[model samples]
Target: MSEVAFRLFAERGFDNTTVEQIAAAAGLSRTTFFRYFGTKEELVLGRVGEFGREIADALAARPAGERPWEALRRAFDVIAEPRPGETGAPMDIIRLLSDACALMTRQWEKTQGWQSMLVPEISRRLGGPGPATDMRAGALVAAAISCLDAATDAWTAGGGVVSLADLTDQAMGVLREPGDVPG
Candidate 1:
């Protein structure tokens, strides 16, 4: 159903596409579509709601001794790129989402919604939860997510030629000084 909707969204603008059209194209009744997705947006952003849990799990799975920033980067790897052995995503979805301002905004909004899911794990890595630790963990998670968004923006603009993980690394690296000198 999502695949059919995505194709329709690609062919027609997201604003122009309707749930009825998606249902018809998918060969499913409107009731069936509603049963699966409450709104047209869900067809696109469904996976995003759980992104925090996914990211947290990925971060937690990293080596225990890994630095927080490195673990964050490694964690984003799962979200940053297509899974191994899968064909690369068709540019149509990227184009579809990029062209829609409402969708772009909503997508980022959804990303923000997941930040809390990552904080506890991040706090754990920062040596357990407390005001100071949680404060720092929250900041780091926000920064990491922002960097990931920037990398994704660049990827969409560049036609996704560069690997997203590399782009994310590049994005995150911009915040750091090249040499280890006394600040």
Candidate 2:
């Protein structure tokens, strides 16, 4: 369903594609499509909940002694790793997102939601909460997401020569620096 929708959107442009058209192209009835994905936005947005759950699980599985930021970085590394047979979907998704503001907004919202869900889990993994725990969690999530966004933007802007991991690390390095470093 998602693959069909992405293809249709790429071919017809987002505004020109309709739910019905996506349904027909995917060989699914309108009711079936609705049952699977509630709205046109969802068709373009894809399975956000599933991906969030996967990231949450990955974070949870990290060793208890791992720093929250480190664990989150590893989780992102896991996410950015290319799958066995997948070719260019990640780059294509980045392009589609760059071309559509609404889709980009939805993607940001999804990332924020996932970060919120992971915070408490990260807190727990780091042992009992302290006075600064919540603040630290929020900051860690924000920094990790900022890294991902910068990485994606840099990769897209560079015509995809630089790896997402490299850009992500560059973003991470900014945060890892001592407080005295000049901007």
Candidate 3:
């Protein structure tokens, strides 16, 4: 259903594509579509809830010795990295979602949702939450998100010539000093 809707969204604009069209494309009734997705936006942003949990779990499981940036990068990679034998599908979904400004905004909004959850967790991992700890957590989360967004944009623009994981590593590397490489 999501793939069908994504194809329709790619062919037609996101705003121009309607739930009826998505339902028809999927060969499902409007009622069934509503049963699965309450709104068209859900077709794009729905995975956030599921993936968000995975990301949070990954973050929580990171070694306490890891730097916040490295920890966050690994957490993102947990969700973003494709499984074996699956290469282009994840990138295809990202590119399709990127084609729409609305979806892009939703992506950021979802990231913010993650940020909200991560800040306190990261703070706890850093010791405890306070002005300084909270700020550090917030800054790390924001920077990691920026890197992910930039990497995703580059991957989409470059037609995925570069591996997404490499791009992600490079983007996260930008957080470190020129002489410093993140492990």
Worst 10 residues of 3 by lDDT: 84-93
> Which lDDT values do the candidates have, in the order given?
0.76, 0.72, 0.76
**Compared to the true structure, candidate 3 yields what TM-score?**
0.79
Worst 10 residues of 1 by lDDT: 85-94
lDDT of 2: 0.72
Better of 2 and 3 by lDDT: 3
Give one digit per residue, the lDDT tens place, for model 1 in 23-99.
Answer: 99989999999999999987777656655567878888999887777788899876775765422142344456688
Mark the regions of model 2 whose C-alpha exceeds 4 Å error after superposition.
10-12, 84-91, 130-133, 178-183
| lDDT preference between candidates 1 and 2, better one | 1
TM-score winner among the candidates? 1
Tens-digit lDDT track of model 3 for 144-164: 888988898888889888978
Candidate 2, residue 143: CA error in Å? Answer: 1.6
Rank ordering of all candidates by TM-score, starting from the highest? 1, 2, 3
Q: How do the residues 1-183 of candidate 2 rate in per-residue lDDT, one tens digit apiece?
A: 787888887898777788999899989999999998888877656655455677788888888776676778777765565555442255456667777777888888877778777777765754536424666666677777888888888887887787777777787777775543211
Per-model TM values vs. the true structure? 0.82, 0.80, 0.79
User: What is the overall TM-score of model 1 with all chains considered together?
Assistant: 0.82
